[model samples]
Target: MSAPLLEVRDLHKSYQLKGRPALEILHGIDLQLPAGECRPICGRSGAGKSTLLHILGGLENPDRGEILWKGESTRGWDRSRWAIWRRKAVGFVFQSYHLIPELTVEENIRLPAMLAGVPLEESWEDLLDEVGMTLRRDHLPAELSGGEQQRVAVARALVLEPELILADEPTGNLDGASASAVLDLLVKMVRQRQKSLLLVTHDETVAGRVGTPLRIADGRLAGNRS
Candidate 1:
């Protein structure tokens, strides 16, 4: 069998308060995500779900243990190396959508690809079509609906053709119908591209839609479920 796309071992993280001891958020987490698979990490607030996702996405580091991308350890990689890896190997989607309000949908979607040195004209058209944002390509984020904004975010995330996508509550800000639409598109994209996805969400129905569902409680991953 081939190696997993991502492996995390003994991952731990903590933050120190001004007048008290350090508050440990994650405790010895171990996870393995195979290539092209989709997994959901479900948990309530303060469960360290977002923290875990950030660590896995290379946006943050664990105080202890390591994250292995493909087969290489991320421990010794410097900031620049991490940035390269993040750009080339991973894509991230967040609850807030985080789009620059001033930029048009197409411009926001093309930003990541441009940063990665991919010509804007090369992938923008195809991505806009894929995410059903072709009509709103030139619309600013403020002019679009929540679902539209998220569609643009998805397009941006995929512009780099990353091997793994870490989405932290990608649909959290949308209404029921809009959230469902966003999730459907996200799942379809992941499956079609054969990219691994790890999503952290509080919605049970959303978690159930993934290939595998795992819960986080008290800083530990619960048993996997179908």
Candidate 2:
């Protein structure tokens, strides 16, 4: 078997709160994700699921531990290096649909590729079509529906074709129909691209759709079930 596409070892993170002992959010998280696997992290509110996702995506630093991308240690990398890694190797989807209101759907989808210096013409049309937003490609975030905005975010996340996609509560704000539609699109895209996915969600039914669900509690990975 080949090495995992992403690996986390002994991961730890904490923050100091005013007049209190440091609050440790994650404690020695160890996980390995092979290429093309869609894994869900399920937990109750305040279980540190988002923090772990941020750490894994290089958005936040771990006080202790290591993250290896394709077997390369990410420790001690500066902000610029981390930024490049994020642009080149990771994509993030958030429940809030973090699309810039000023940018059109096509522009939003092209931003990451542009940051990575990928030519605009290379992925614009294909990505828009893939997310079924080609017809709405010229629309701004505010003009789109919740599901449409999220779909644009999904397209943007895939524009760079990163090895791993990290999503935090991706369907949190949508109605049941919209949620199911968006989730289905996300799963289909991930599978078709053969990219690894680690999603943080509260819905057990949604979690069951992934390859496996890993539960987190008390700052630790509790259990993994198929």
Candidate 3:
């Protein structure tokens, strides 16, 4: 059998206060994500859902544990190494569309590829078309609707063709129809590309639409292996 695309073992993270005991956020999280699979992590606010996503995407570090990519451990990897890997292997989408207000749609989507020193070839156009943003290519984030801006963010996330995508509350800011549309597009794109997805969401309906639904409570995966 093929190895899983991503693995987490005994993952733990804590925040130390200035003069108090450390606050534990994650408690020995163990997970496995196969290629071409989508996993929706559902939990209440402050349940460490976003923390797990951030750690997996290299935006933050775990206090103790191991994260393996295709069987290679990320232990002891320096910040620069993590940055390089994130650029090439992981894509992150936030609830708030993090597009540059000044940059046009095309520029926003091309930013990752540009940072990675990749050429702006057919892939750019292809992504714009894929996200249905071809006509909005020249518009700024301020000029687009919430759903449209999120679509641009999604395009930007995929610009690098990363193997793993970590999305945190991707539809938190949109109405029902727009949220559904954006999420459907996200799932379609990731599945068609065979990329692994770990999405953090609070809405049960949203969680149910994704592949596997995992619940997190008190910093531990509920009703599943911890």
In lDDT terms, which candidate is top? 3
Q: What 10-residue stretch in candidate 1 is worst by lDDT?
A: 118-127
Report the C-alpha lDDT of model 3 over 37-81, residue by residue, as the tens digit: 898999988889989998998888898899998888989789999
Query: How many steric overlaps are in each model, in order?
Result: 0, 0, 0
Model 2 bad stretches (over 4 Å): 121-123
Question: For residues 1-226, what per-residue lDDT tens digits would candidate 2 score against the true structure?
Answer: 7778998898998999999999988988888888889999999888898999988878888999999888888886889999988888888999999999999988899888777887766656887888899999899999999999999999989887888999999999899999999999999999999998999998888887765788888788866544
- Candidate 1 lDDT score at position 35: 90
lDDT of each: 0.88, 0.88, 0.90
Candidate 3 — what's its lDDT?
0.90
lDDT of 1 by residue, 44-148 (tens): 989999999988877788999988887789899999999998998888899999999989998898888778886655655887898998888889999999998
lDDT (Cα, 0-100) at 113 in candidate 3: 83
Deviation (Å) of 106 in candidate 3: 0.3
> Which residue pairs does candidate 3 place in steric collision?
none
